[model samples]
Target: MTRPHDAAILELKNLLGPKGWSMERDVLETHNREARGKFEGHADIILFPASTDEVAKAVAICAAHAIAIVPQGGNTGRCGGAVAGQDQVLLNLKRMNRITEIDARDFTATVEAGAILKTIQDAAEEHDLLFPLSLGAEGSCQIGGNLATNAGGLNVIRYGNARDLVLGLEVVLPDGSIWNGLSKLRKDNSGYDLRDLFIGAEGTLGIITKATLKLFPHPKHIATAWVAVPSPEAALDLLALARRTTGDAIAAFELMCGFAHDMSVTHLPNLTRPLASQTDWHVLIELTSSRPTDDLQSLLTDLLGDAMEGELARDATLAQSDAQRKNLWAIREGIPEAQGFEGGSIKHDVSVPVSKVPDLLTRGMAAARDLIPGIRPCPFGHVGDGNIHFNFTQPLDMDKADYLAHWENLNRVIHDIVAGLGGSISAEHGIGQLKRDELAHYASAEKLKLLRAVKAAIDPDNRLNPGKVV
Candidate 1:
C-alpha cells in the first residue's frame, strides 16, 4: 500500500515523469541502505534527475513541500550519508552520468554528478590526460560522491584529495536556486571560496549536480616496487629518501602491515607474496613521469638499493615488467576485500601527521590488543600522507555480533589515541550520520557554531540532507 505521502509522491512523479522517478518498493529498498550495512532507513520515493535543470526542479518541489532531500551518488559511501528516512525523498544522481566536456588545453574535465570515477579516468586517458582521483571503489563510485565526501585515495600522496583536484562546481541550493560556479580558470580569487564548502559537506549544505575537475598529463613511464621496511619509522624514512632521490616523481607511497599482506595472500586468489623475505612492515612505492625518457625504472631501482643499504628496508623487489607492476599493486589493493574473509572487522579511517604515523600505529595497536586480547590489527594505507586504515579483525572464533558490539568502545579507544596524536578520526570519509556524534564530540564549540551558522545561512530550512554532518 502506498502511504499517506502519496500526495507529494504523485506530484514528484508527474514532475519527473515515469522514467525519472519511482515509488517502487524494490527501488526504495535498494536506495535506503548504505554500503557498510551499518545504517538503514526508508524512503517513500526515489527521484532520478538527468540534468541540472531537472535536479533544480525536483529540489524546488521538495522545498515547497518541506520534504527532506537525501542526495545520493552511486550509494557507495561507507558512512550512512546517503541513507534516507521514511519522511525524506531519495534523490539518486546515476542518470546524470555524463562527461560534458574534456578540455585538454585547459587541463580540466566538466562532468555531470553521476559520472563514474573510472569513466572520467578513461575519458581523460582518451585525450592523453589523467584524472588521478583513484580509490578501490573507482569502478563503481561516482565523481559527485567522490567530490561530495572529498575522497582521498592512493594518488592523494601526489595529487591530494578530491577537493584539491576540483576547480569548480554547479550546485543546486536548498531553495531550488542553482549556483553556476563551474569555472575552469585556475585563479578565481573572488570573495569567499564557496566551492570548497560543498565539496566535503556530504550533500548536507547543497546538492552537487556538476563539477569541473583538474587533470594532469598522463604518465608515460612508470615504475613500481614493493619493499619490506623494518617498521613504520623505517617506512617513513624510505618515503623521505624516495622523495629526495626521485624529486616529485614519487607518485604513490602506501604502507601495509605484514599481517595485512598475509591476510590478502591467504584469502585472495592469484595474489602471491611480493617480497622474498618476511618483514613486519611493507611499503609499495610508485614513480611516474610524463616524459618517456625519464627512466623511472632505474630511479626506483637505485632508491630501493640505497634504502636496503641504509637498513631502512629489510628487502625490496622492483617490478621488472608491466605485469609485475600490476601484480604488486594487486596485492596492495586486495587487502580491504581479503579482510572480509576473516570476520567482523572494526574499521577506522584515521589520519595523523606523517611524523606521527609510526606512533599512531604502535600505540593504537597496543591499545586495541589490550582492550580485546587476541584482536588482529590490519593497519595499512597512504602512510606517506598520514591516513591509515586502522582496522581490527575479530578475535579468532569470536562471535561476529559480540565482537561488533565493542565497535563504539574500540572506536573511542582508537580515536582517543588519534586525538592525542593530533589526528583525524575520519581521513577520507566525511562526517556522515555514522560519525555525526563523534564529530560533535571532537569539534570545538566555536567550530560547531560556525558549521551550524553556515548550514543555517545556506539551508535555513534544513531540508537538504538533514541529520548529516553538522
Candidate 2:
C-alpha cells in the first residue's frame, strides 16, 4: 500500500536529484538509529543538501507540503534529537562540509555545518590558534551538531560552551527563508540575538547551515596531572586552590568516582591507575599557557604539592612526557565508552551547584544503593562546571533487559534528588525526544509558555522537528 506522503517524497527526490535524496532501506535504518541505541524511529525520506541554497530550496519544498523536517548533523547526539519519526523527512547536512575561511588575524574560522569538529581544531592549530571545544566524539561529531546542542566539553572550564565560542551562524528558518547572521565581529548588540536562538534549539527553531567560531591563542605549554582526592568536597577545594594559584590557567577539571575509574581499568585495555593509592574520588587536571616562556609544568607541580600539604589531595601523579599526558586524558575520555562493557547502565547527565556536588553524589549514591542493592554507581564528569554524568551499572549476574526495565523508576528517584538540590535533569544534553516529556514535568508553566511562544512564532506549522523540545 502507498503511504500518504509518497507523492511528496517523489517530488522531493526529483527536486534534490538522485545523489541528494534517498528512500533506500539501508539509508533509512542508518539515519533512524541514535548513537546510544536507546531510541529509534523511521523517516519518510532522507535529503542531503550540499549548500545553503540547496538547503533553503529543499526546506521550501518540505514547507510547501507541511512535511516535518528533522535536521541532522553527524548524528553523534546522545539524545534522540537527530532521529525522525514516521512521515517526517530526515535532512542530512554531511554533504555541506566546507571550511570556507580561517581568519588568523581575527582568530576566527568560518565553516559549513557539516565540517567535523576535529578538522576545524586541526585547521586552527595550523594557524597557531586553538579551537578549544574538546570532546570524546570530536573526530566524528560535526560542528553544526555541536552548535545545535550547545555542546559543553572538557575545555568548558576555560572556553565556555559551544554557544560562547560561536560568533555567528547562518540558519535556514522553518518557513524556508535563510537568515544570514554569520558575522565574526566580537560585539554586535543588535536585535533579538537570533544566533543564540537557533543554537541549542536542536533544530526546533531552524537549521544551522554555517558558523563563524571563536579561536584562542594556541597553548605553547601544557601540563596534565591526575590526583586522588579524599572526597568530592576536597576535589572542589583543590579546584579553587588550583584556580587561585594558577591564575585561572586550568583548562580541564574532571572528577571521577572510584567505581568509574575501576570500570575504565577493568574494561579498557592499556589503561592503568595514575596514582599509587586508590581514593574514593579522582581528579584529572590540565593547565595550558599560550606564552612559551610560562612553565606550566612547574606551576602544576607546585599546586599539587600545596593540595597534598593541605590534605585536599591524598596522592598525585604529574605527566612527565607527552605520552603520559595522552594516557591520563585517555582514561578520562574512555570512561563513557568503557561503561558499556559493564551492562545495563542507566545514565543521567545532570548538573548541580559546584558546592552541592558532594551532597549530590553522597546522597544520590546512598539512594541508588537503597533502591537496588548491589547496583554500581559510576558518577563522573566536569566537576568544575557542576555537571556530572550520574550513571548506574546494573547488578552483576542480572539480565540486562530486566535491569533496564527500572530505568524510569530510577530516573524519578535520582531526578527528584536533583530537583531538591536545585539542579537540572538535563545538563549538557538538550531536551530531545528522550527528555521531551521529562521537560514538561520539570519546567514551570511560564517557561513552557515562553517555549511554546517561540516555537509558534518561528514554526507555527509545526513542520520542523515535531514532538521535540516544546
Candidate 3:
C-alpha cells in the first residue's frame, strides 16, 4: 500500500522543523540532479540533520513508514548516487559540517560528514600534517561523499584512495541504528571489519555521519616538473625512471596527450603552454619527502638528465616556484573543462595495469576511430597508477547531438578494450545511474550475487538511494 504523501510530509515537517527540513521545490532543485548534470530525480522533501541523533531519528521515522531516504553530501559527486526518486526524502549532510577532533599525536582527524575536503586539508595543513586524497572537486566535495565513492585523485599514486585514508566510520544504518565505530587506533585487530563495508557502498547500505581519517607527516621537500615524451610507452618508461630515482617520494605522475594540452590552451583561459617542445605526450611529475634536508630538485634534475640521455624523455621543464608549478598542473587539471568546449565528449574513467597502458591506449584509439570516422581520442590521466580518463571529443566539424548519439557505441568500444586488457571500466567514479548497466554487464555473476546479497542484508527494504549501485 502506498503511503499518503500529505501524511508523510506533515510527519517529517513536525519531526524536523524548518531548520531541519525543506519541501520547497526551488530549494530542492539543486539536489535533484547530479554533478555532471546527467541523471535527475525528484525528492519533494529534503532533511538537513545537524547531528547523528537527528539523522538516526529521521531515518527511523522514514524506515518505519517505508519511505526511501537518499543520503547526500555537498552534491559534488560525479555519479548520481545522491539523487532520489519521487516521494523520497533527501537527507543532506551539509548542515552537519564540523571538525570534531584533530589528534596530532594519534595522526588522526575526526570530522563530520558535511565537512568539505578542502576544509579538512586546511585543518591538517595547520598542524603540519596532510590528508592526501585530493581532486578537482576538493573545494566543494565532502568527505562522506568521497568515502562513499571511494574517490581516487592526484595523490593516489602515493597516498591511495579514500578507502585507504579512513581509519573508522560513524554511520546511520538503514534500520536507523547509530553505529559508533569511530576508532582512531592505527591498528585494530577486531573481527568483521564492518567499517570497510560502507566505505564504497554509495550509501545504499548506510549513511556515513562522521569519519576518523589517517593523516601523514607533512612533506618537507616538494618538487614539480613537466616532461615531454614521444609516446605513452615513453611516459611509462619515464615513470619507471622517476620511481627508481625518487622511490616512494614520487607523489603524482599524470600523462596528458599533446592534443589534450593543446585543447586546454585553446579552450581555457590563462592556461599557457608548459613545455618548450610540443611532444605527443606530456608527464606532470611531483616528488615529496618528509626529510627536511632532502634535495628533491637536484634528484629530479639528475633523473631527467638520465632520462634524456636514454631517450625516455624528449624534453622537460622544472617549476622554479609554487606559481609555476600550479601553471604546469593547470594544463592537466583543465582537461575536462577544455574538452567540454571542444564539443560533445564521451568520457571513460577506466584503469589498466601500468604495463598495459600503452597497448590499451593504442588499441582503444584505433578501435574508436574505426567505429566513428574522424573521432579524436584524448586519453590522459594518472599514468603512474594505470588509471586513464580516456575521453573522446567529437570530430572538428561534427554535430554535437550526432556525436552524443554515439555515447553508448563509444563506451562499448573503449570498455571492450579495457576488459580485454584485464582493466576496470569504472576506476574512481561510482556505478551510479550512468554506469549501472555497464557494471552489471561486466561484473562477474558471482561478484554481482555477492554484492546484491550484501546490499539485501544491510538494506533489505532498499529504502536508501534506490536504483543506484546495486
Candidate 4:
C-alpha cells in the first residue's frame, strides 16, 4: 500500500531525475541516523538536488502535496537536526558542492550550500586569504550546515561565528519561492535582514542554497603554546594578558581539563601530552599575524615569562616547529573523538559569561558529583568565548546504558545552574530534537511567543523541517 508521503517522494525523484535521489535502504539508513549514536529519525527516500533551481522545484512539489522536508548538508551536525522522519523527504545538498566564485578584490567567496568547509578554506588559502572557521568536523561538515547551526570553532575569538562570516545568503523558503539576497556588499542597511533568518534557523524557516562569506588576510607568522594553569580563574587572567599583550593577534585560546587530555592520550597511545606538568587545567594558546616581521614567538615568550612569574600559568610548552604546532592541535581536537571510544558520555555544549565560567565549572562539577558520585568530568573548550563542553564520562563500574539513563537528569542539573548564571542551554549546537523541550522550558514566555510568531509568519504550514527550532 502506498502512503501519502510516498507520492511526494515520487514527485521529488521525478523532478530531480533518477540520478538525483536514492531509494536504496542502506543510503536511506545512513542519512537517517545522527552522529550522537542516538537513533533519532527515519526517511524512506532521499533527494539530491544539484542546483537552487532543482531545490526550488522539489520544494514546490512538496509544498503542493503538503509534504515535509528536512534539508541535510554534510550530516556532520552534533545535534539530530539533519535527520528526517519516516514520512518526510530527505534533501541532501552534496551535489550542489561548488565554489561558484572567489572575489580576491572584494575578499569574498560565493559558494553552494553543499561545499565542504575545508575545501573552501583551502581555496581561500590558495588566494592568500583565510576563512578562519576552524573546527574538527571542517573536513566533513558542509558550509550550509555550518551556517544553519551558526557553528563556532577555534577562531571565533578572533574571526567570530559562522553567522559573522556570512555577508549574504540565498535561501529557498517554505512556499517554494527563492529569496536571492546574496549581496557581496559589506554594508547593506536594507530592511529586515533576511539572510540571518536562515543562517542559524536550522533550515526550519528556509533552506540555505548559497552564501557569500567574508574573508581575511592569511596569517603569516604563527605562535602556539600549551600552558598549565592553576585553575579556570587563572586561565581567564592569562587570556586577558594575552589579549592585552598581543591585541588582535590572538587566534585561539582554549581551556582543557586534564581528564579529557588523558582520555585522548589513552585512546590513542601514540599521542603524547603537550605539557609535562600534570595540572588539572591546561590552556592551548595560539597567536597569528599576517606580517612575517611580527615576531609573535618573542611576544609569546615574553607573555609566558609574565604568566609564570605572576603565577597565572604553572608551566608552559611552546611549539618551536610547525610539526610541533600541528601535534599540539591534534591533541586538542582528538578529545571528542577519543571520548567516543571510552563509554557513555553525557554531553552539554553550553556557555556563560566569560567571568562566570569558573563558577559554572566549580558548581556544575560539584553538582554532578552530588548527583552521581563517581562520574568523571571531561570539561573543555573556548575559555576566551565562554563556551564550554561540560561533558561527563560515566563511572568506571557503571553500565553504559545505565549511565546514559541519567542524560535528562544531568541536563536538568547543569541547565539549572546555567539558567541561574543567565547562560544559554544550547550554545553552538542548535535545539534539535535533543534540546527542543529544554528550549521551551528555559526560554522566556515572550521570547517563545516571538519565535513561534516568526515561524508562523514564514512557514505557516509547519512544512519546512517541521518540529525543529520553532
| Cα lDDT tens digits for candidate 2, 373-414 | 889999999999999999999999789899999899899889
The sequence of per-residue lDDT tens digits that candidate 3 reaches over residues 1-470 is 24427766677777778898886878789888677887886877789988898899889888888889999988887768888887788899998889999889999999999999999999999999999988998999899999999999999999898899999999999989989999987788878899989998899999999999999999898899999988898888888878887876899999988899999888888877887676888899999998989999999999999999999988989999999988988888888888888888889999999999999999999999899899888988998889999999899889999988999988898899999999999889888778889999999999999999999999998888888986
In angstroms, the error of model 1 at 135 is: 0.3
| Global Cα lDDT for candidate 2 | 0.90
Question: How high is each candidate's TM-score?
Answer: 0.98, 0.98, 0.98, 0.98
How many steric overlaps are in each model, in order? Answer: 0, 0, 0, 0
**TM-score between candidate 3 and the true structure:** 0.98
Steric clash pairs (candidate 1): none
Q: Each candidate's lDDT (Cα)?
A: 0.91, 0.90, 0.89, 0.90
Q: Which ten residues in a row have the lowest lDDT in candidate 3?
A: 1-10
RMSD of each: 1.6, 1.5, 1.2, 1.4
TM value for model 2: 0.98
Over 80-138, each residue of candidate 1 has an lDDT whose tens digit, in order, gives: 99988768888999999999999989999999999999999999999999999999899
Q: Show model 1 residue runs off by greater than 4 Å.
A: 1-4
